[model samples]
Target: MSAFVVAYFPHLCLAFGGLLVLCLSMARSVPAGFYPVTAGLFAALPGLWAVAGPQGGSPIACFYAGLLSVIALATIGLLARYAKRRGFAGDALYGLLLWSALGMLLLADADDWIMLAVGLELASLCLYALIAARLDDNLGTEAALKYFLPGAMALAVLLFGMALIYAASGSLEIAASLAAPGPLTAAGLALVLIGVGFKLSLAPVHLWTPDVYQGAPAPVAAFLSSGSKAAAAAALLHVCSEVSPEAKELLWPALAVAAGLTMAVGNLGAVAQGSVKRLLAYSSIAQMGYILMAAMAVNDGGGEAALFYLAAFALMDLAAFGAVGALSAEIGDRDDIAAYRGLGYVHPWRAGVLAIGLASLAGLPPTAGFVGKFLVFGAALSAGYVGLAAFGIITAVVGVFYALRLLAALYMRESLIAHPAAVYATGPAATLALGVMAAGLVGLGLFPQTLLGTIAALFGGA
Candidate 1:
């Protein structure tokens, strides 16, 4: 029992943290910052243990669990001011966030179909409620509804795929099921891919992302794009690792085509977006395309590259959306691209952080995003997916334009909002969180080996 508790302390910690935060909400004298700070501190414990503690799990699983914890911490940091200002700063919101982190941690370590389903649903169900945190807003309600219905259908499809796998393999193990090849296995894997693809916002099934993101609160959008995507991507990479050679031959081509389409659609869609959140939503989709390309190369050094990119993406995305949340007026989010005009001067620190995030997402050098892209492309080329790599490079170039467009609005354009002064001011919480993320992006870019060396060591020099 002690061994079991030690192995699973991180999971137990999160469950306890959620309840603790819920109970703390009952106190009348607790400071407004107490909840987010307390939540962040509790969330950080798992990450700290995963990073500095003994490793009993695979390096990949440890890395992902730690990554999810950091994501939770950073999100709570940014959520501090945004939550207080938006009137949603309470135990219920923090409880949902902590519980969802528990789910993401589970998904990151899952090795079977049942575990994956449970983790995915646990994470996803909380996200649906979080999106509608602003209960009074019709847009929030609609966004939650849109996400929930599609998500439900995807879960059904995924469950059916799992059922088919059980029929073929007569076991619940992911490894056994993937290694057991037949027509049923093939169809089952295909369905599973479709279901996961929808969650990751890969194209053809990614129609919900933009509207949902635009309508959701900026902090909530950050959680959805970063925490949810990271867990799903990590889970998909684990699944890819378990595939047999024959199954790979069949699955690889289909995944490659999907990557290409997702890259094309996401970059193209982002180019025309006037809403900042919508643009980031499309960019988030495109980022997944690149990550998917790396996932295909898992046998040939893709695991390390995928890990690096997911970490960098979570930082870049949370920083970007956190800045947006910081700059939002009490009335609503300053979501319009034009609403940002002259705010660079009005709020230099927040705007600068936003710029760093955008530049990194555009694959600018001296940033983690640049190294992540280079590593991803290198992994794809080395793995013999040259066409996908080349196409990813091209789509990446197109992605740059939208980032530049947003930056131009920030720095070049004149004030467009009727009262730019009415925009919310940045507090210590957002500043500290965004600053850490921005610093990490540049630090990793300049010293790519900080992460690269870790990945190499973890995989025995993969």
Candidate 2:
């Protein structure tokens, strides 16, 4: 019982924290500001700390739990920052975000098929509600519908896969079942891959990502990209690694093709978008391609590379969207690249933050994004996927072009648009968040060995 409690502390915190927030909301005295979010944040800390602490000696430090901690913190930061200006469903958002994070943490550490299935449903259902919460936006409603329906179908496929696996192996524990053998088991694993492809936004099945991200709130879109996707990737990596390799020979090639297609489609789709948020939505798909490439390299230092990239990716992506979210409040929240025309003069600091984010996203030097790319590409090359590595490099270069468009728009001139005296009440918190991300990006890039060494050690145990 103690072992389970320690392992699942984060989920417990989220559950209790969410209930408290919901009660406060219903009482109609939940404060008109960021207090409820602050309370939630405070409540969730023990769980986050417990998970982050090197106490368990479990070797595998629950990737889903750690990722959820990161996401929960990021969401807390975003909610607190946004709560002051727009009082739109802040309490509900906070509670649901925690609930969703709980689901993610559960999904991440799931060692069995049933646990994974339940976790996936919990996270997906929360997201469906969140996507539909933007009452005034038809786009939000439509996106929720589009995402929800397909998501349901994907869940069914995943459940079916689980059933097949159980029938073949007579067990749901992934590690144990992987040790068992049969052709039916192989087919079961293949079906699982198909389901993962849908959630991970791999090609053909990724048709939902762009529309959903474009339609959702900027912060929500960022969560989907950074938090939700990272959790899914982590789970997928575990599944791939623990499962039998007989299917890997066939699976790897298909994933590689999907990675290439995802990058090509994501980048190409972004090139024509007028909206910054929409462009980012497409860019996200492309970036997922890069991450997927690393995932495919799992047998050869790929997991470490993937984890490293996930951390770097989350920091930079969140920073980008944070800047967008902050500015959106001022400029009609449209986040069109053109809307940012000459923003540098009006909000120099925010523009600088945005620039750092974009440069990092472009995989430019001195940013952690570059080091992340190098690690992934190196892993791919080591695995003899040289062509895929080359494609990643090419697409990364192409990404720079789109990222620079923002800088160009900013540097041109100051528009007549009035700079709203923004009340980022937790100015220090916001600044600290950006600084942490920026510093991590540069720090990891410069001294890549330190992080790699740590990750390598973890990989040994994983």
Who wins the TM-score comparison?
1
- Candidate 2 stretches with Cα past 4 Å from truth are 34-54, 57-64, 413-428, 459-462
Q: Candidate 1 lDDT, tens digit per residue, 201-263?
A: 998999999999998988889999999999999889988988888888888899999999998
Instruction: Please give each candidate's TM-score.
Output: 0.96, 0.92
lDDT of 2 by residue, 1-462 (tens): 887677556667778877666667776755745544454575456445544653452334444455456556665666566544655655777777777776776676678988887877887888887777677778889989989999989888888878888998888899888666677777787778777778778777888987898777766767777777777777787887776667676567887888999888877777787888877777877878888888777867788888888878887878787778767776776567777977787777777777888888888999888888888899899988999999988888888888888788877855656655553433555666666666777788788887667666655642
Model 2 pairs in collision: 368-441
Pairs with steric clashes in candidate 1: none
How accurate locally, in lDDT, is each candidate? 0.86, 0.74
* Residue 82, candidate 1: C-alpha displacement in angstroms: 0.8
Best by lDDT: 1
Candidate 2 C-alpha error for residue 331, in Å: 1.2
Off by over 4 Å in 1: 26-32, 330-332, 418-423
